[model samples]
Target: MTDERLIADLHNRWVFGWERNAGDDPFDFRRVFGEFYDFDSPDVRLYDDFDPEQRVATTAAGYGSIWEPGFREMISAHHVVDDGPHVVADLGLAASTLVFVARITLPDATTDIRTTSSLVWRRTPDGWRIVREHNSTKVLPAGALDHRLPARRIT
Candidate 1:
């Protein structure tokens, strides 16, 4: 396949996997990461040059931190602002990385938070699989609280 097609496929697979994980279905690390990821380790780092045998361990550690209950709850309400073909401005490969920005409107809250994320994928026999991902969040500025009011007034 052409490099462009390969990259597109990889990007699509990654987005699908992420959306599925965010859905109501139980989060299955094994299914999404394959048998090469280890969920018990304290350090999970994904790398293209790392030993294949140790990949699972690193992936588990890294994802465990991001997929914790609190994180999931925060992400559950997120709304995707843009989801499409990536520009791939500097990355060596077409789908080497995907950049997307989303907005999360919290329930019972007036301010909405915007989150930007990037997902990197690697091609394997099983097809394109996510090798790494990072997400950053930003919240809208709020009015200053009255100092005279109770400490709880600071919201």
Candidate 2:
């Protein structure tokens, strides 16, 4: 297969794996990425200096406490509102890296959040592997609110 096709297939598989395993088991790092990749390495970083270890730590801490469990769950669900073709903006053969962007909608409690993600992939001996992923979420307003009293009223 052509380099472009290979990269595209890798991206799709990476996203699918993340969405599938994230839902069932958030701690299964291997399921979310290629066997050779490591989320803790400085080479891999997330928003605000958040690395894979930090993310795992946050997830283990608790739900809605400094970390959003829903977000993790959403990632696992990998729900895409509209499936569209992904375009490869640039390819660096020497570095074995491919950069591309994908737009997807996530299923939220009340609003469907749209997210555009940028992924960096490197060609590995085994196959194409994702080295980095940055996701930005756009939250939509909720339509209605429950009139019922709060489960626990705050002072």
Candidate 2 lDDT over 34-148, as tens digits, reads 3434333445433311222344221212212323443454432334423433545345421222222222223533332445555555555665544555555555344211222
Model 1 lDDT per residue over 34-69, tens place: 533334334434432112223232555555444434
- Give RMSD (Å) of candidate 1 vs. truth: 10.1
Whole-model lDDT per candidate? 0.41, 0.40
Weakest ten-residue segment in model 1 by summed lDDT: 146-155
CA lDDT for candidate 2: 0.40
Which pairs of residues collide in model 2? Answer: 22-76, 23-76
Provide C-alpha RMSD values for all models, in order: 10.1, 9.4
Quickly count the clashes in candidate 2. 2
